[model samples]
Target: MVRTLLALKGALVRGALAQLLAAEDDIDVVGEADTPDELRSALRAERPDVAVVDGDLVTADQLGDLASDRPAGCPDGGPPGRLLVLVQQRRAARLGPVLAQHSRRIGFLSHDVAPGRIVEGVRQLADGRVVLDPDLVVAALAVADSPLTPREREVLDVAAEGHPVRDIAERLVLSAGTVRNHLSRIMAKTGARTRLEAVRIARESGWI
Candidate 1:
């Protein structure tokens, strides 16, 4: 049997999906989680063959951590199992980095896909295959190529939250001067006359 875990935000959705997948003779619903922490705990406890996660419930960084060979909470430091993320097309760009890092082991599907598709996706992922929705593929590709370096992106991400240079520095543990320098580079790369404009451009372009 293919052991599966469901990690969506809604209790009703989780229960419904569990019932759907459990109806398959070859599939078993091993566990369910409604939050990132619960997902981690369930992953460590069940060590399932596949995990179906809602993209809205976890950030890209959290997904990256879970996608690592030895994910957080895994006592034996073993693989955390394959992931099939249910994400909206608009939010797909945020997954670029993690998808690039764990291409083969992770798959993406539209959040609103038919229930049968999700069930089939779990089987495919368990068999070591990658499944990607065409619309999400296009959405991921449509994200503008980011000119800013990773550090600049980090600075801009904090800046996007309306944080000042000093706050950004403190949050990122960088010197204030360094943060200012990063901001300057970000503005130049984005060709924006002001920091707010830069943040707007970066956000609209899905660079941050």
Candidate 2:
């Protein structure tokens, strides 16, 4: 049997999917989680063969952490099981961080896909196959390359939320002058005359 864990944010959706997967003769619903903490706990305790996660509930960084913290005795020192992340097509860029790093054991599928597709995806993942939604692939490809460095992107992400230099610096643990310099470079890289415009450009291009 394919042991599966559901980790979507919506309780109704999670329950519905759990029921759907449980009906499959070859699949078993091992655990369900609605939050990152619960999901982490479920992963460690259940060690399901496949984990169906909602990208919004768990960030890519947190996914990386879970992958690295796989239960001891994982074959070849790799993650204990496969992960199938369900994300909206427009939000595909949010997965860029972990896509390349965990491509082998992680799959991305559009959340709007038919329930049957999700079931098939779990089976495929359990068999060590990659499943990617075409729309998500196109959306990921459409994101423009970001020119800003990691620190610049960090500043821009904060700026995108309308935070001023002082607030951004305080939140990032940097001085106001350093924040100003980062903003200046961000503007130069994105060719925006104002920080707000730079934020718009970065967001439109999915840099943040």
Candidate 3:
């Protein structure tokens, strides 16, 4: 059967993948989108068998949105199609939690993978199969045993935005000293020499 596809537009690499997939006799490139709004619009208008999305379209906080939009199951659980995100290894940890939960219909590959791999991934997604890069999976599992708590993660997330401890305290309704204590513990847990390093670790691990 001929499969329809929509690629969320971003890096030039995605364009190459689109052209490669379009060359396949069994696949048709139906649309391309540059933003989330455009992607949604194309989804409604094209009704393709699969959507090739950029990792930039997904945020750490949108885990619920991805899950709600496409629950964790096979072809019958949620929408009619699936999603294939182009995530780099650097972003794998941040993208892990969501990936772990929604591995059924949602798939991902490294951004720098070969065109043939991308074509194969698209075909798999069109066939209602899940495709996750092995390296991405390994990176995801490496951070699975995170040592930070939700409150600590929130603190680090605020710190990551270049906020001062006092400002983070005010935002979280905690005292400045309490925030410092949290940061101290966070540093210990993450083995980070400084608050900034802790924040970086948390951000990379999707802890925040």
Candidate 4:
């Protein structure tokens, strides 16, 4: 079984995750703490296999303190797993550099992820890897209808080619539904009803 540590705010959020993880045969909720202090204590004592830390737990020096050492397995014997941050929203831009700086040590997830997805993330993070839910990733990239990034522009360009979401998704290595969803968002941003119209407007406005 994978031993886990949960560091989140809000009684409700903690309760929900606790119940869900408790039911999993493969997961063991070794510790639960509310703030940075309590969380630090729990971490030191438990040395959990994976740490699902909410962004609210700490930041800057406090956050750095918690992350002072790499993730370690329970009992402090085997190599450490990983520390995954659960944020209220995607802090992609802000975390991009930080994550790069600590590539093998950090990962992120949205606080609203489904229970099953959260468990799955625990398994992955405990094994040391990056895992961000797709829908949240899309939402993060689509903020500020004001503009789209070059990568988003590329996703939109390939999606608008009438490639049929499935084929386009295959070509882009994105889920079919994700491709369609991106097209819908692109349409909304450009104030166009159809894919072609959206592409034309986006191109003219230099959004792509």
Candidate 4's TM-score reads: 0.57
Q: What would the TM-score be for candidate 1 when compared with the true structure?
A: 0.72
Collision pairs in model 3: none
lDDT of 2 by residue, 33-150 (tens): 9888888888878889999999767655677777667665556654678889998765666566567677778888998989999999999999998788877766655544768665
**TM-score of each prediction:** 0.72, 0.75, 0.66, 0.57
Query: How are the candidates ranked when ordered by TM-score, highest leading?
Result: 2, 1, 3, 4
Candidate 3 C-alpha lDDT tens digits along 100-149: 67788678899888778877888898777889999888766655677876
- CA shift of 161, model 3, Å: 11
Candidate 4 or 1, higher TM-score = 1
In terms of lDDT, the poorest run of 10 residues in model 4 is 90-99
Better of 2 and 3 by lDDT: 2
Best by lDDT: 1
Model 3 RMSD in Å is: 6.4
Clashes found in each candidate (C-alpha, N, C closer than 3 A): 0, 0, 0, 1
Clashing pairs in 2: none
After aligning candidate 1 to the native by TM-score, how far in Å is the CA of 207 from where it should be?
Answer: 4.7
Q: Which residue pairs come into collision in candidate 4?
A: 71-80
Q: Name the best candidate (by TM-score).
A: 2
- TM-score head-to-head 2 vs 4, winner: 2
Q: Can you rank all candidates by lDDT, best first?
A: 1, 2, 3, 4
